[model samples]
Target: MLSQLMVLFGFFALVLVSIFWINKAVRMFDKLIGDGQPAWVFFEFTALTLPAVIGSMLPIAAFAAAVYVVHRLSADSELAVVQATGYSPWRLARAVVVFGLIVALMMSILAHLLIPNSLSQLRMREDEVSRNVTAQLLTAGEFLHPAPGVTFYTREITPEGELRDVFLSDRRNPGSAVTYTSSRAYLVQDPAGTRLVMVAGLAQNMQQSGQKLFTTHFEDFSHDISSLVSRDAINLNKLAFAGTPELLRDPQAVAARTGAAPGAVMAELHGRFTAALMCLVAALVGFATLLVGAFSRFGVWRQVLVAFGLLVGLKLIESAVLAPVLVTAALWPLLYLPSLGGLALAVGILWLAQRPGVWRRIANAIWPWWRRARGAGA
Candidate 1:
């Protein structure tokens, strides 16, 4: 049973991760390729995103594997034969519990190490890509809008790396607009930032309120263009990129560095643990749910639906607690409520599966009301 669970888990995890990864890759391809970036950059970005995608899909895959394995065993009468030999539901669930622990260990590694490192690397790469001005503005005879309210055009480019007949309009300022027309220009990078050094340029400033135009000519003038091309610089101090140990050791310090509230930091720290614990909960719920009621030749489709619904309910509970937890650090314990609730639910289902008389009694009590309602509707 353990071997079957492991095999199915790998298969389901691969299929799910591939589907989600392909979807994300498509959107990244459009954005990166459309921005004139090379194919290698697109591949690097997609590869960096794999850890996060795998992390999100593992719990679902584990749940599916557990459910499918149990369903197949019951369908083949293997479970029935085992039960006849006095193997209780709890005993049968031991393999499933061990499988869940293995998956939980995988989740722990991803949440604590791989995910944070990948996200940090991704952010750094994005910063580099955003600042690559040549790739963004090197084409000749075409107008470029590197940012909203900014337009740049160069009539020609010399092999010597000089821009000819450059025209630039900056309307980012609401009170006045500036237009710079230069006979020649060079892009310069310095310790400060990137700048466009325009020679023999004419600056035209137009006041929006009065529609007045003022013009000035210069031998050379430098205009800061870094903000136009790049986004805000990457801040590595973000809590999302911090290690779990760092977060737990001094959450207030982490909060200060990331400019988040202390409560938010605590919530993030606990959220990681809860995410890993959820893997165990998901696996157990899947196995225990299928163990309920008698096996049918028609299969346990209803039990599968119940298990799916239970997972959804757990997620809903998780979402519902997040806001309050974020508002108060003391409520950090609430983050584990969903996982705890799921474990309780799994235990309850397993107990019910062990007691056939209890199930019959409950069904008998509900069957009369179900029949009466059917007759009234008819």
Candidate 2:
């Protein structure tokens, strides 16, 4: 039993890592390339994204592994042999349940520790890349668009790294367009962030309706470059970024400190635990769904599809609950409804799987719909 559980778990974990890592690497390549980042940066960013991917993959992997293991056992006649040796279906499922618990614990650790840290690191790395790319745009002899609707050009770079001739266009502001031309300017990094300091510059402000261009000559002017950088949409006060203990502490206090919605924070706290606990339910559901049907020489592809469909339906229900609970924390308990419902459904399915009469009844009831689906496909 231990050997079967480990083999299935290891197989699923490997597949999970490969598929998700490749997917993330592809996406990260496009993003970093668009930002003019190096190849190493692309690899680094993709690598940092893996922990979060693995965390999300855990429950699904557990379910798939459980389904596959059960299918394999039934096919090999080992499960039948065990049953003939006086082991009940439920008794045979103990190792699978243990496997589910192991996965759940691993996912809990990720939800509480690794995922948040990795996500935070991704945020920091993205900011760093943005800052570097934005700063590099100040090179002489070429026009650069640091961000959409923001253009900058410098004619020359002094030994002291000052801009000899600077031209900037700001179209980010609605209802007006602004341009700055300076004989001398410099980039400054301060607590506020990167700023372009224009010395003896001409400011041109054009009104949209009238096309009236206003010119103002000034000795000193500054434009903020921080807005041009893409950043994580995460609110610092967001419950997603908080540690487990911090989240469990004073909800109101944490919300006050972060200037976030207390209800949202509280909802996030409970959601993490539910995320972990759902692994067991997912595994049970998959196993029970497959076990319901008679052993097939053709294999359990139909049963696999049914299990996958059930999983998707459960996730849809879970997503439906999040909307209301996130806004109204009083409904926070609704967050666990999908998992609880799945658990109860799994138990009923397991009981039916053990009883041929009940299983036959279910199969008989489902036959029409199954025939309809086959007919439609044909």
Candidate 3:
């Protein structure tokens, strides 16, 4: 049973990860390739995103695997045969518990180590790509809008790496517009910023208020083009990229480094721990839910639906508490409530499975009302 659970878990995990990863990759492909980025860059970005996709899907995969395995066993009467040999639901659930622990450990590794590192690297790469002005502006004979309200074009490029017949229109300021046309231009990088040194250029200025135009000819002029490229300041000290130990040992320091509230830091730290625990909860809940009733020839589709609904409820509870927990560090314990509730629910279902009379009594109480309602409707 344990082997079957592991095998199915792996299969389901692969399918779910591939589905999510491909969807995300497609979006990234369109954005990056549209920005003149190479295919390799797109693939690198998608690879870095894989860990997060897997982390998010792991619990769902674990739940599906458990449910499918249990349903198959029940359908084959293997569970009934085992029960006839005096095995209790709790005894049979030992394999599932072990499988859940294994999955939990996997989640812990991803949450604490792999995910943080990948996110950090991805951020760094994105910053580097955004700051690459040469890639954004080096193409000749085609107009480029490096930033909004700015148009740049170069007629030709010499083998000596000089831009010829360069034209630039800057309409970023509503009150004034500036246009620069140069016979020859060179791109220069300095400690201050990127500069386009245009030789024998004409600068044309127009004022919106006066509707007047002023033109000036210069022997050489330098235009700051650094702002033309999008270079958003990368926050290297993001809380999501920090190590768990660093977050735990000195939350105040981490908070300062990440520019986040103490409550947010605490929420992130505890959220990782609870994410792992959720895997265990999901697996156990899926297994225990189907074990509630005796084997039926019709299969356990009703129980499977109940298990899915319960999982969704747990997720909703998780989402509902996250905001409050983030608002108040003291409410960090609320992060565990969903997991605890799921465990209690699983235990309750197992207990009911052990006593057939309880389900029968509950069904008997509902059947009479159901029949009366049916007769009244008829």
lDDT by residue for model 3 (1-378), tens:
999999999999999999999999999998777666888999999999999999999999999999999999999999899999999999998999999999999999999999999999999999888887766777788898888999989999888989999999999999999999999999999998899999999999999998999999999999999988766677899999999999889999999888998889988999899889999999999999999887799999999999999999999999999898778888888988999999999899989988989988999999999999999999
Model 2, 1-378: lDDT tens digits are 756766777788889888978987888787677555778888888878888888887888888788888888878887677777987668867877887788889989988998878777877777677667444565678778877888888899888888888999989887798999999998888887788889999999999887799999999998887777665454454456778788787787878876778678877788789888889888888888887767678888898899999999999999999888768878888999999999898888888878979878777899999999999999
Task: List the candidates' TM-scores in order.
Answer: 0.84, 0.73, 0.86
Least accurate stretch of 10 residues (summed lDDT) in model 3?
130-139
Q: What lDDT score is found at residue 325 in candidate 1?
A: 84
Q: Who wins the TM-score comparison?
A: 3
Off by over 4 Å in 2: 133-135, 138-143, 147-150, 153-235, 361-378
RMSD list, candidates in order: 3.7, 5.9, 3.4
In angstroms, give how far residue 210 of model 1 lies from its true place. 9.5
Candidate 1 ranges with C-alpha deviation above 4 Å: 138-142, 147-149, 153-167, 170-233
Winning model by lDDT: 3
Give a tens-digit lDDT track for model 1, residues 1-378. Answer: 999999999999999999999999999998887666899999999999999999999999999999999899989999889998999999998999999999999999998899999999999998888788756777688898888899889999899989999999999998999999999999998987789999999999999998899999999999988878646757898878999999988888899889988888988798889889999999999999999888689998999999999999999999999999889888999999999999999999999999988988999999999999999999
In angstroms, give how far residue 291 of model 2 lies from its true place. Answer: 1.8
Candidate 3 C-alpha error for residue 363, in Å? 2.0
User: Higher-TM-score candidate among 1 and 2?
Assistant: 1
Clashes in predicted model 3: 0
Worst 10 residues of 1 by lDDT: 130-139
